[model samples]
Target: MNIKKKSALVLSAATVMLGLYTGAAAQQIEKPLKKNTATTFAIVVDQETYNKAKQEINAYKSALEKQGLGTYIVSHQWTKPEEIKVVLQKLYSDKNRLEGAVLIGDIPIPMVMDAQRLTSAYKFDQARFGFRAAVPSDRFYDDFNLKLNFIKQDSLKAGNFYYSLAPESAPEIHPDIYTARIKAPAIKGKDKYELIRTYLSKVVAEKEQQNRLNHLMVYSGMGYASESQTAWASEQVALREQLPQLFRAGSSAKFVNSRMQGDLKQRLLTEVQREDLDLAIFHQHGESDVQVISGYPNVSFPQPSIENVRRYLRNKIQAANRKKQDVAETKKRFQATLGVPMAWMDDALTDSVVLADSLFEANGNIMMEDVDKIRSNVRMLILDNCYNGSFHKDDYMSGHYVFGSGKTIVAMANSINVLQDVWTTELIGLLQHGVRAGNWFKEQAYLETHLIGDPTFAFTAEGNTDYNELIVNKDGSDPVWKQLLKTGDADLQALALTKIFYAQGAASSSLLKDVYYSAADASTRMQAWKLLSTLNNADFKAVLKDALTDPYEYLRRRSANMAGDFGTDDLVPALVASGIEDWASKRVAYNSGNSMSFMNADLVIAQLQEYLKKPEFAGNTDIQRLIKRQEGTREKVLKEGKVMEDKKAVAKERAFDVNMLRTYTYHELVPQAIAIAADAAEDHKLRLAAVEALGWFPYSYQKDKIVALCDQLIADKNSTAQLREEAMRTKTYLLHFSAEKYQTVAKK
Candidate 1:
């Protein structure tokens, strides 16, 4: 173990002082507690397991009771997850007796199956490109209050959490109910009950132990996000300013993008595997199988983008390409052109991303598979990413823990978008004041409900038929109502307006116009636009034109989407300006169009193309709206970020998906897309997406040019293998123009 620094421990204000209770048997505490009971818990067990492990179960009760908890043990057949929720809710409704609950034995986990039409990663080559859904929820069990975010049309979301210690693997029950929080000792050839005991024992000791370690590893992976400028990176200066009050000065090890040694991920892993560090915080994109940290520097540029040799060669002749039109970062911010690197995502699985031989197993790459080998005394680990917490014991035992550790994993319980800064900062404050790791997310889930009056992590415009019922008709005394009627706080006022619209379902043009024109919140302005669309066509058009100068990106993006929907061709220039406005912010549409949440960005990007068709047809309604009904402007905007964020965005990282898969045609916007496809400075994900759009470019106006573009890509020796392969696939599948079909024309 390596020691970084030394410090005196400061007692937390919220820390509980434990009284010694020697040699006491466990006793169950029933309802109607004494007025001054210190703490309470519910221990839920599978009825079958109680018969075999009644004594062992009693030990669990004793362990918790020794820590000053009034423990209650209950057995249930565990029929439906809803039944479990009702039981817990009924217990918690009595605030005096319930603070948290533990599920012991083979409790079945509930799942949220998110089936959306968005392009999902093709499982294999033979799979057709089509819309799909997944179980994206990670924290389904935490919200006993019950709001699963899986309701968008074509989207089936299940946010129910049930951690079970069954003999069968989780996949056998459901493909998505993975909890990467624990290292199942079944892999170590130990009994599962013994592992649970170990976990409970460790937690109890850590919370009660007077000794404290101050060292922390603060890690931020500034890897290849959509674009370099939009790295899932937040400034460290904010952390520097806020941390010392909670932790000792100079007791932290920060691994950020700027200050890195040999390999960023390797360095961080080396320290974490050690038995010394107490806590590690990773702030970046991650997955169930890997953490998207700084990759091989040789393979990835240290800056926003790498110099594209091909762009310089082609720039002289291409006058109307998307590159020429793009004004986001290249010409506007960096004053240079850069492109995605040649090293593919597959590199992470090969020597392309090699690790120190001793540190990594024979097959491992950047992803460390050493949670089961943890010699560390770490108490907690926080990974803020989708599906990162989808860890299972079998994986750890088989040496496949993606980001797993022996410590309690603090992560998003499901596949929902959580504001990292807000929740993380709050958690740190609680920990500093002595809240246990096991209880952090429970506190967070409940707090989220109180703050926004909802238990779901994300809300979308797609298939939530229950939004009106959920948002509307709240108690008149709720805080949002109070703010709406009494105060002028912009955020609260905006929230109030959205709730009112949902409850009433209609608004006169004058009332909508007032909020549209003068509501202080940008979100409020955006919400006003949706309701205004219900008005006369002329009124809607006028509002969009006026929105051209709206102060925030949210309103402006919504205006652009409305303009597209109405087919206002004259506003092309305004749409372009908005599409590229503050492009690096990494919103759902990201540097394209900011249609409320992810829908309009998706709509407007293609809309920018489709509406330009023929230069005469009023805005065509052909482009489908994926999320039609949203909770509010914030739900429309922030929630879409959750939807559009790709699992592995860059080329070859995720399965190939072209938004044009459904349309398979190019509108007049091909030139703009061509400009993007031809540009070297664009993000690889965007460029690849553009290339796919170009694959079917000949479907309409570019029909005559398809053969030439395909041939050009196929013959280019310098093009990425990925691009060339995709071009070949397009020719093989979509165009039906194989070598045999073009052999005679190829000679020309």
Candidate 2:
């Protein structure tokens, strides 16, 4: 059930107001329901689910209320998210600022369609099965500003505006929506409410077991990309810095899975069998039932445009076989002649050892059954990869391993958009707060939606952790800091700072400034920026102005995001003068084309566009010159790429550097710039790709072709809303650029 509404079934105030249901079998009493009242958290449940699980919910709400979380239980129609939006708006008015929300029941996440083409379809998680439509993000309600007047549904700006992204295919149903799998007596045969209740009950029990004997842990699986691919491969190295808050990581060597000594399953099972873990986190590739740890070699894989490369290799194997060579001899000849690394053809790449056989294997990695079988108390599990949250429908199958009978409350990305590096930093930061797993996971998702620009990742539990404990205490840290300050030990002090302020807590700005200036270590200094980004909300104007100019380019580049998130028009001069460089090598092709990734630069550009829209900065000569400078630089880069890519006469088994693309692109570019040029002529890649960026340039320079063609795209309702938005936004960008040339602001 995709939860599309067929008819409206409205429940009146009388039905909802009557609460505190007590039954002959039930000793628990439900409290009175609060509506239109201020509360810290909002729990939105569907009517059908509410009626079925009334007793369980009452007990749950009662528990939450006792913990200082005044709960608002609101029943909503499954299809009518607009009504839910109304409820949320009322809940988050000027009088009340909500901290978070828990969406209960099988509520439909209405498909989000961006009016601008700023986003791309994220189908990484479900790519294996060609099932990616479910970008089930709660963004629509979460970011609701509550001003949308939809009497005749109008522009997005008219209401609660949130980011929008769609998948290539529709996403599948979330497990919480329908019970297709799970055999746990606590979950199966019961409605989704009971199953979720069982899962929560398990979390409560697991928390009770955390007596400081259970360890907090991090798990990094096999490399999806090589060392050269710093964006993805740098995950573990980055995570190493955040692991200081956990216990005995230095002493517990066996629990860590840095080396793939055996199969991934056996290694994980061994860790679980040996000791209880309070938190277990993984950074790897995953599907609904499988996790990809260490990599075997996959660079030989060809992009769709270069399928001939596959034929080229297969022909070598066939020729050797025709010569009556043995199978091994033929494979060796093929490997030798084709020049594809023989190491890449290793059969074990998809073998039983490195992958999770949770769904289909005789005996393999932690499947659903293994959740209880781990033989130790496991509280929380986080799988940071694609489609990792999609639970399978069989009890003896994947469900046992996925949503275990509360063995662990999991955190994972529903759609794959490269979450490893981004999330590990955010996760470690949240863990410092020592918030309950559920609250911590909610914060993770909320931050992720902003940082990743995709609001599709999810936390399994909502409205749960209210322990209000801090993972890193000043008491444990004050002595270490005092010792470090007395000894003038920078290295030891850096470690102490990690235990004190890696993330999620606040310290005096004066104290943080002292640490920032005094710390000799760069990493320690960077932590100061991390805390400042969150804790120092005031004077961001002045703070960002100074930080963006820091000599550390990494720190300088990070300031782009910080400034963009909290900056107003006033910060434009500082951002432009900063001229920070970001790693813009995000590539599109492995065998076809490698070009400079325009991701970070585009963020900078977007911030500037916002400035251009302001009355004070709009059409200013200085701003115009800066915009032109960036536009010209991009044009030059594109032209250079065009020349280098044009040189590819034949598809090599390796990459053609659209200027060193072969070296650093690591076939991660998939294709050289020339291939992109070729593909556009064959298809529409180049024209479509440049539509938005080119918008920043003068239209006359492009002979107005972009404006005309893109206008047609905008008018074509048959085309996707995403493409049209891209077309119109680019037009808007160009008009802004054009108006600046004439020293006037464009009305758009």
Candidate 3:
């Protein structure tokens, strides 16, 4: 047999071993596709769902076709993620390239593990928590570059297959096609098929009209970026540069903070109901079922403060009672700890006050039940929070927003907890140029992030560029992008830079560096920094040196993040100076402190000691506090490393502990981990974990040591299979990163 046939047979055997239903129905295209069509769209569904909602599905397909898309309906009784991926791959390779797809009804969900680097801060212990900690991702279908090793199908949940990133997979994500989920909520007393049918009709009706990206409503809730007003303000400044058309005369841009309104929940609902509202951005904490809208209310005077304390006490007492805890003891503890009067504790249990406080907290958030009551007119929503897009659950917050009595067509959110450090609005300007929602979302490159609802939806064009055509037709390697960089349009230039970076890899650093210094718009400069940091070359180091002091708060915050990863001694002086100068920005200050903890403890301490002698910083409490914090982290890491030497302790537990060193990316600990990894007497699991942890230190100054150790382990025939495998993976990652870092300068 040929190589392709042999590979197919092996894959088939693996699918059977995983218990995937191989005899299930295959994809059935609705009509013969035209080879000459410029672009194509797909609506994927299970056979039962397609059969039940055929009329509505056809109407949806017709609406897409009416908009000039070559739409196809692909129906299958899918039992494996590979089934759907195969269809998408075939469509993508067609003459009419598949631009976007929407997975409707019961399609396979891929749960990915061992690929934290592809995600924007989703790192869970797959060894301890198993399947529960795995990220439910659709990158299996969209990103062709990722090679997943199928683990198994979930024992309890059909159609949920678990896979791990193959050791040789790319370190980063760049999706080949954009995709979204349109699954109906599996809730009691509701017909899921009916829900799907009605949603399809809604999408069809909305496509008939043209909606411009003119009005934007931005809400910042509590506990996001520590409620840093500077982070909030800097985001708006970036927004202005990104969506210049929205900030022009006659367009509406309203920023509402949790502290700005007495009833923030009601204010949000009222704003979402506005017919003119095109996009609503919610930067807050969220669960699968609720959008957290408020923190403790800001109050003046002693009376309101007393009320707040009373409210908290009453809630805690009530919770204790429900848990069957000793209520008397709880109240006594609260009084003693808080120094509140016994009478106040007694008053806190007043039936009316307890009930009122409960109501206040509930009313402050937009719950899943609350979504049923609102008729939101916002065409698109970006839930910049955690678990709002958890479509794997029976019910989810983003599902409610899209499927409720609303005009909401799409929502971008995460299926798992997400990080605040991500550039959330990176390619948002593409919306103003009439790019489809999915096409723009594909550029985000986060694993847990997903687009719920219609992926092909777009706003009315506000610019001359047909971004839809450009995104679908133009290859990133095309020389035309280089020419487009000469254009004065900042957003367009940013787009060109992104394309060029993807095409040339680190070889594009010279152009990116030039743009970083020369670009007049903060948006372009910010974009340049974003792409340049990924290269990690000398230019990246130079950019970080300058950006640490750059006036842009967001840029400085990101620079601090990279400083922790790079952790070179040369950056310590500027890193400390900016940490002090940008201390007023809470997120920047937090990130700077984190970077200090990750850097060489001795170097950081020496710098702080010198700073203490300067008149400007002498006796500064903040500097003193930072010095203590860095020392404390170093001491703790040392103590943890000592535990790895304890043969009496559980080796598996020690392995888990060693694995955590990667979380801090403490370069100073790399050599210690290397020692544990190289020790033949160490437990196999512990040594393997140590080798895996070394991969996370690709940016460390001690990376060469890890590379040498990896080579030694790979060459040693006596090494255990697990140790050798992990060593090879670590070596691949370190070498690939090194190559990408310096490839641009090699030719020069």
Candidate 4:
């Protein structure tokens, strides 16, 4: 059979066996403990791609758990040889237990190749599903005695697919592999220039439609090994010449050229205007202490020399002497007087301490002064050079310094002298494709495949390569790429709903409503309503109104809950008003009733109060139960002298109630929760609870109240750790939420 047929057959057999196994172990599997039975997965990615993938994996794991799958996640970085070996060994040893493996970038391919070799040696079952970027050679399968599946597609083909799918008005083009090739002559002086131009034009067009181009930046660097000083200088000259050409026609578009020489800080400042620069690009050599300047002809000049070395030695000696002098003084003063002490051994007898100090100080000063200008503008640096993480004598170069005022997102080639230009090109292509909704890591993967024509290029951190290899976490989270692809519109409401549902089952009704409003389409709105329905009773009035006026019955039916808790009486009126009757009415009523009972309201009391003269609500069990519960609770509270404490407790409970209630509303939910808490009955305990719940909502509205509550909580002697934690969490949430909101609104 062909590969497709073989794959199908293998999958079918595996499914059948899995079913049988599950059936045989039904009793043992029935009570899948929330804990234990670790489901581990590994991913190999560069540092730049790690966070996004991790987030995506985490989200997917939660989604899977909701579907009743067990999962866990483990990550490893694979830059060093030793680290690679360790990850391979682990995968080999536990390959049988591994449900799946995902490899993310090209850097980890060699290591994965090694691990595949050891699979059979360790008796690892080849049947475990694996996903990777770079498609392994046939030898990978033959040598390991395994079956390998590769997901591959050409960029030009993908571009064609996109063209077909996009609107006709959207710069229509015929699908042809040779189109890029034919167009190459027009932009012939530079390699890949036509492709880059086409990609940029498409991106620019998309950005114009979206009215923003702040999300992505391209990094193009020196492509290969520097053979000599002349070759390096030539590369820099070529880069500088080409940069002006690339920017010639796209002057309106912002660009960050990586061709400048000297300190990164100075180069960045010179090439990029402060206000115009949204992203940065770096194209040079990097080691532990220094990044190469493209224009700098000689690497030897950039390398530190022994000049001013004696000062470092003298500084080291002074530091040691101070430490020794303090040893004889009082602990506090002595410790304080160590004068920015260095970390090293001190032996006064042989002046070893002085010698060591001098050497360290000398080295630091020399390196620091040489690169001071570059360091200043190297904000958000993306190192395209190899071995960027290597050590400089005693200290590491890559992770040593903070980015100062700006956030740093670095993409380093971990292997010694590895060419990152191919990876960089692929990254640019993927960015143009807009895969994973522009998620940085997923984009990296898509870019990798386009560049290398491989599906298993693993992107991971230095030591966590194995963890990165696993597409799904042990928790069964979806791959980062999948999540980003799903987030097509960057819907904040949907994201918030997901986060709340995963964290706390109940969200606010107002919040859900806001999500519905924010939705660009009926389907998205329906999805929001469906999620809302899961957490609380469906609002029948709202459902019927939307059903009659909105064009989607899917949303209407989705809004129909099988349970009732509160305010369900409103459904029948809504249905009647909408002219829906008979079976539909009956279904709506049934679903409404099913939904209302969970709201904890005295529906019976309202019914009795309304129909006492007619006796219509006399026998309503729901009404009776609600009335009894409310009255009993109220009577108990009034009779007890511990009203203060009870009131606070009730406030807290009510706060939770409001929080749960607001899960239905997408935008107004948090504010409503806070409002409910604020309006809660005057019991101090109740007030406190309400205040605490308000803190949990995104800190957008009622800032004054939130601030006052936090202050009060801090001062209150009665506050417990739980209350304090809630207060602190609210403050933090508000700070972050406000910042995000400001940035989003500012863009608008």
Candidate 5:
């Protein structure tokens, strides 16, 4: 059948299935009895799965209702993502203020495009890759503030639709309601409907018991931050502040590192399988099918036993053969290195024992095939990696963890590549306050990040009040929030300050700054810094200067990382001081080095000279090396700028350089981008890339220059249609972002 005919047939089948399920579901689907004061939650499902698991779905609703949530099972044959978004928007505004929703069982997926800024670290040429470049996100449904322009549905994938976050929409993501996906993976030899039924039943059973926010396990794999020990250690310290109770005398908070064990794969499996383990965090690199936990096993270096040498030779020979290399040459090269005989090499190549040993040793990573055998009892799993939560794929890691034969109910992950610099554990302390996992995920709202499981899943409360209840009710007054700020719980105090910030905007700037200094808890201090930075007033510059020396290492690291965007000479002194003093901390030193490249180069150089003159740095041998590194990074930036404008360079490589400028916005590149965008003789694709890159400099001091260039291209009648279109987009983005920023200033 042709593509048109196939789509028509799918539509017809969807319509029929909808009619049949709606007729049957009138009895099983529970409509909300009370919509007042945001007490309702939604379970949205596709019709076919609802028909197959009606009893299981109803029991899941009962489980939520027992927990005081007025549950609604909205079963439909979802063809377009917009249809679901409309339903969610209506629910959000109606008397039944929706707190959260879970899209289950083959619901339509929205692939968001042209809004890379909303993501933590996702940027691609949408025109080149088309639908594939777009992110599979449910933010299209939950974030009502974002105005999206529906582009079209995927011609091949039935339920995949493309949308763009309109430039006129909200500049930042503040999701109106939390959302999760409970979709089962489309694995062969397994019935997805049966898996959904089993998973729903497990969720019901799991929710029946009181699950507490204790027994945490955190792991770090190789290749993240180049395995930076400082970043890894700081996370544990931050987690202690986030989950204070976990660090208490008898409670459990285990930290696992890949290098700590020779066979970490089995050790991770054993730890995850522990019944008492409440949460597991996998901080590593990943793909749709596998979690890359580590590289080679830790064996003795420089010298090794004969058996280990033989094992390494066997694995290398097998790899060479698989890659169509000459196995004889590979074996001979290993022989020369080890002085082994040719007969021994032949045996290593042909022996089944060698192959078996190679297979046994190659257990560093976890693949989709490894998921089915283990019953993971960890209540929640956080995959802090890339593409591990791609629910649209047939065999995704997060979906298998939730719906496979496991007690793992919820998993948080990203659908695309995410930045390592993101604060993954932000607002995590709310989990101890009885806030749902979905709510915690919602607050750290990135376009690509998602929760893959029940949205209503929550750990038992440690304190007297369920903070989720107060947040849902929307009855928080200034007086109530101020009272909470005085409470003993630091996370609660942070949440209260967030509420006040949202309501009062920059009006609360003074209070936030006060809290930043006076608050004893690191969590509260970090929260104060976050809100203050978002305001970006004069106070932000003052606080940022002080934060470089803040007792909280993570806070200091973040401050140094962001100081480049402000691009003022005032911050140069602090940035230099931190870079010199914090050189022992790999991530802090690394970020500070990068931040210097975007600041005033002369100011940075002057600051470095002053630092070298100090008596404390008289004997420091690394100072000159650090100065050269700063100069080298600036030179690298200059070279990359030239690459963006070089017509002789490969188009894809030049476009990549353009995208990187957006990630690390350097003011020096702004004029080059404007030049490329203005020259009509330039390649159309490159010009458009230039236009888009200019939008990311909203935080740069040279933003007005960008705005002027965008306006010029927008008005020129001789401009190409594509150029004009992109210019309009960039202009809208700059204006909307600036308006939002100054709105907070206006409130102050």
Candidate 6:
């Protein structure tokens, strides 16, 4: 059939199948409809797999529509695990009308998992289907009540397909293969693709010899074989037949094969000599040390034996040398001979030992046997598989087993479960397309930008990627990950401001401020202030002002917290003049009781005095009690000069300097005692004695200052904010009293 005719037939068949499937599905549903709306069935896949999966899904949707069941297909390109959540949330929120979802490949698995969580939170009943590699159903099954299904594709099916199609006269296929064996039930679509490719290769080769056919075209070929030499051969023949004059008559015909597996070294060598093949393509599981090839039953070639791998490597190296070339050069030459660039497509292999070890150590379990191997061979590994990145520190390493200093990069999914294979393929395809289009590194950055929409989603380095010259600028500034890691004092602090910003319900303003206070980096401190401006609280005003003048310009521009719910009384005039108007101005008001806990006594006294001047406070019984208690405590402290014996008389006397007590009222005596407690004397005994004497004052008035001073001493700072605030309060009180006296004299 012509290409156009074939496409039409495929589309028609797909539409028919979708209709039938939808009709059958509608008949099976007995539940009452909550609403009549078209439901979206979204699938996340790699770009290459997208066209195929989308075609199938669209067909399914069309079929369903025919049966009067609403269905729409939402497709997303998967580059990162978090992209799953992002796309799902958008679909769920916008489409609130989805009844069921079908996830294909790795990116969709995490999204579906999160969707299950969201459904439980929202109390919605939704069915989910997962298609790709198998997942551990136990984690979400009970909570989500999920009905799960998987496509199991392994090495065994790949091996059997290769063996069945091999020339009968070739070496006898091994029946008891140990490493390349894969357990059935094999992946449905994959098996069909393998069978079709094997059949086409034989047919095309025979026809070319007898009839001297210029070209051949093959259709319905999928999976690994679609990228192989057989497909390439068919394409070359078809092209030659169509464009006779465009090509030189004597030009050598080239064949390009993709997705080749099982003993690649041997297979490529054999084809290069016997079939005069120029390029070989293989895709399967791969790691730093070995590549997995399919074998009989459940076995795979190139198992994790170092000696066996070394021997294979040695042979290949020797073969290349004898051919007077390097391996990469030889591979390139082979491709050139075949007239097509060899393309090997497969997901990056994650080291099982690394994953298991990482998980075991994260949970505080120790597996000592695999530590050495993991450190040595598993560098620059990408866990394109699902759930591989979920392992924490204890899961793989105990404190005793230190990771080696090696050039390795390990990227994996943070969530638990294997991601669908399609996501990996799509990411690789995007990367390849981008590189071929002359924007290699920018593509990775673009992927990251799309995945982590906010500054909070960090792209950090592990192993060699951490040390890449590309990561560090010429000035030797720390990389992004290093900067992020050092932003907060602890993991919880880091989460509150950084990672938590991407996920909702993960942080609060007060918690974020605490993180800011502890943060050493000026940039991070500014970030905290920016986050605080979004909240309706007065506590952040002073801190925000401090950050605006911070040495870092990045901090100054971003940390403008002038507005947003801050109390007018608390906001300094200097802060108001800074021209920061991006936030709200309605501050969270606090009463005396609330202020007492968080504020120092000086601040509390100042506020109380202001309240007492008001008609409401003047008539209140609680205000009267608070005033009487303050008076009684002050009188008692004055009468009994040194209440505690711990303080030496001379030290106590020196601490209570009369000049410090500007207020004559008994309440003013408390500040004198507080000042004494914080005095740093030469003798430790005298310091303790002075501290004891200060204890005689009302604890409420003196407690905050003493604690603040102690904290300052520990931090090795000159004084605490509490001390400065108290001094300012004392200065204000003296000025107010002097003005009142002057006014009285003037009136007389």
Model-by-model lDDT, in order?
0.40, 0.41, 0.83, 0.33, 0.79, 0.30
Ranked by lDDT from best down, the candidates are 3, 5, 2, 1, 4, 6
Candidate 1 on 1-748: residue-level lDDT in tens?
2232221111122122222222352212233222333445566666665555666556656655664455566555554454444555555555443555655555544434311111112111212332222332323444432234322332232223423211111111111111123223234455655555555454444444443435566665543223233322332322332333324564654545523545565566676665545556665655544565653233345342232232322332132233465433322222333333333211222332233322322222234344455543444555543334443223321122312334432233323223332234332322432333333343233111111000111111222223222222243234555355344433234445544543343333455677778765454465566555543244556777778556654444345544443333455546554544434444313323433232333444544455445455344332222122212433433432332244334543322333532232224344445555555665665655656555543223343354456567678787786666555544433332122232222110
Expressed as tens digits, the lDDT of each residue in 1-748 for candidate 2 is 3333321122122234322222322111122244433334555666666676666555655555554455656664444456666555564553434445555545543333321122122422121222232343444555442122122222442222223332221111111110111122223444555665665455334333323322555565655322224333333334344443343453331234434444667667555444355556566666555555543323444563234344344444444545775657666766778676655444322435223322323232344444545543344455565554432212222234334433443344443234333333443433443443433333344211211100111222212432232221233244545454443333334434544442213443444566776665444556655545434344333555676555443344455544443223455446544432222312111100111122233444665566778886767664455456556645655555554355344433112223232122211122233244223242243333434333323312232555676677777666456556656655654443221222321110
**Model 2 per-residue lDDT at 489:** 33
- Tell me each candidate's RMSD, in Å, in order: 19.6, 15.1, 6.2, 31.0, 6.7, 33.4
Candidate achieving the largest TM-score: 3
Please, what are the lDDT tens digits per residue for candidate 4 over residues 1-748?
6999996674344221112222223101111113333332233333333333444444434443342334333333333322332343344345333232333322322213112211111112122222221221212211222222222333432211010011111111111010000011111133333332332233222222222123223333332322223223333332222222223443332333333334434433444334333234444555545555433222333223222232333444465557775432333343356442332222322477556645543332213234323332222234455444332122333432221112222232222333332223222212222221112233122111111111111212212223322222321123432243254332222333433333333334455566576655443455456445434333423543465334333333324432221223444333322222212333333333333332223443454344433465466564445456545644443333232224455544443443333222112233443443344245444444445445433322345556566666656677665455445545544443322222222100
TM-score of each: 0.45, 0.51, 0.93, 0.24, 0.88, 0.20
Task: Tell me how candidate 3 scores on lDDT.
Answer: 0.83
Candidate 2 residues lying further than 4 Å off, grouped into runs, are 1-39, 94-96, 115-134, 145-194, 204-214, 224-255, 272-275, 295-376, 391-402, 427-432, 437-443, 446-689, 693-724, 727-748
> What TM value does model 1 have?
0.45
- Candidate 3 minimal-lDDT segment of 10 residues: 11-20
| Candidate 5 lDDT by residue in tens digits, 1-748 | 8999996674344332212222334312346543343467888888788889988988898788778788777777666776677767766776767889998888888888888878887877676787778998888888888888899988888788888777567767778889999888876688988988999999999997887888999988877765767777877877887898898876799987776756788888888888888889998888998888776555676444555666667778778977999998887787788787666556655668765766665587888777777888899999999999988777799887888777898999898889877777877889987898877787777998999988788899986776776776544344778898888777888888887887767677898999998998877888999888776677777888999888777788889887887777778888988888887677778778878888877778778878788998875667777678768877877888788678788878787877677777887878888888888888888888889989887657877888888889878998887777777777776665432554543210
Q: List the residue pairs that clash in candidate 5.
A: 35-96
Per residue, candidate 3 scores C-alpha lDDT tens digits across 1-748 of 8999996675344221223245854456664233355688888899899999988998898788877788778777877888778878888988888888999999989999877767777778766687888898999889998899999999899878999778777666778899999998754567999989988999999999978899999998888887888888988987887888788899989998887748889889999999889999999999999999996787888998887788788888888988999999999998899999877768556788777878988987899877778887899999999999999998999998888777988999899998887777877888888889998898785999999999999998876667777777886677778787887667778888988776677778898999999997777888898887667678878998899877777888889888888888899988888778787898888888889888878888889888899998889999999999988988987877677667777776577678887687878678778988998988776788789888888778888899999999988988987788778778777766653544653210
Better of 3 and 6 by lDDT: 3
Q: lDDT tens string, model 6, 624-725? A: 554454455445545444432224556444433332121121233445455454565434443333333322222123334644544444354554443333
What stretches of model 3 exceed 4 Å from their correct place?
Answer: 1-25, 32-35, 648-653, 739-748
Model 1 residue-pair collision total: 30
Cand. 1 Cα-lDDT: 0.40
